[model samples]
Target: MTDTVLVTYGTTNGSTAQIAEAVADILRKDGLTVESRPARSVTGVAPYGAVVVGGALYAGRWHKDARRFVRRHRVELAERPVWFFSSGPLDASAAERDIPPVRGVQRTMVRLDVREHVTFGGRLEEGAKGRMAGMILRSGKGGDFRDFGAIEAWAHRIAEALAHT
Candidate 1:
């Protein structure tokens, strides 16, 4: 039998969406039916056998829509299997990974008891398409540093969990 998997995410520069698609591809390869969509497009979680939610982080936070989806479907999510991922914290350039104060969607996910969560490095375009992100980028912070290997490994873990349960 095939499983219905919903992979949803919120992205600023679209890196998170790329990550989500990669995850969905992994699941699809496992013989499951996967649908990838933006978090804002999701109306309900009732139709999915499993839910994978992810979003890019801005200023130490997950996107609002991703968090809101979990909040709106908390009851259903709790009853089913849900996995979460965040795209944030560009390369440390050193050994230290210091996460700032908890804020936004991440905080909301914690309250909802999501089964698993992962964080991947995000990228920022140095140009001036948007001022807020550009400011952060210009601050000498960093750029896209997502580890595709780690992402695939995490997706496989979720697949295993769903397979056994």
Candidate 2:
């Protein structure tokens, strides 16, 4: 029987949600029963055979709900296969390539023994149009720098790892 997988994500400007959906799709194709839900919507982790948690980075912080979910479910999560992903960075500029402050949460999760964590560049959507975004965009500073090929390859790797466990 296929294992149940839960992909819970927190998104502010929408890129993280899209990335989570892509990961879920890849898991489903691998014959896992997958459900993609917003982080706030998640009630419990017990139903899932494996959990994949993801969040967006904003101003050097992860979405609050993502942090809470992990904190609340840390014990259950530690007993199972878990993976983490963060959707951040806009392009190949020095700022994007450099580690952002919001990345610290991944290290915290690693301490809890999450099996894997991956970072991927996010998108700049309409709602993300803010003073900072505008300044960045006006400066012609960033572009949609997400690497779909790499994302897919990572998803495949996650699937392969899960299959063996």
Candidate 3:
């Protein structure tokens, strides 16, 4: 509870990482200390006052690393404010509507009492790994659909909530 926030994510092609960075940057600009890192790399959550976990959606589920992170830190995370995000839906749908978290993610949210959960548009670019990604690209279904404005706005809300707390 030192007013430091940890923004961590599991990304397959790096888009989720970028979103985490954006969230961390906004928190920093709002006068809070923040760290952004990969979900699997974090050893513990003892040093953070709040946590933001994000994952890339794949085949209707959250990234495995993200799920593992939550399971590993559930005890510590339950004592602090926590937020979750999922980056998927390679369309504008995420931006146009509030996409509910996948079933597993929803379960985690309830278990952790997460402050909020968001579903952001995902990015599948030309060099994304995996045969499915290549197929999506060839089928012309890959593109960047994340809305920075919405992301910043969400981060700002987090900052505001933290300040009040």
Off by over 4 Å in 1: 93-111, 127-129
Candidate 2 runs further than 4 Å off: 93-103, 129-131
Measured against the true structure, the TM-scores of the candidates, in listed sequence, are: 0.85, 0.86, 0.98
- Per-residue lDDT tens digits for candidate 1, residues 7-122, read 99988678889999999999888778899999999998888988999977766667887767777788888767788888867675211453432455556566666787767777
Minimum summed lDDT over a 10-residue window in model 1 is located at 93-102
Point to the candidate with the largest lDDT: 3
How does candidate 3 score on lDDT? Answer: 0.94
Pairs that clash in candidate 1: 123-144
Query: What range of 10 consecutive residues in model 2 has the weakest lDDT sum?
Result: 93-102
Q: In order, what is each prediction's RMSD in angstroms?
A: 2.8, 2.8, 0.9
Clashing pairs in 3: none
Cα lDDT of model 3 by residue, 10-129, tens digit: 998999999999999999999999999999999999999999999999999999999999999999999999999999999999999999999999999999999999999989989999
Question: Among these predicted structures, which one has the highest TM-score?
Answer: 3
Quote the lDDT for 74 in model 1. Answer: 84
Q: Count the backbone clashes (under 3 Å) in each candidate.
A: 1, 0, 0
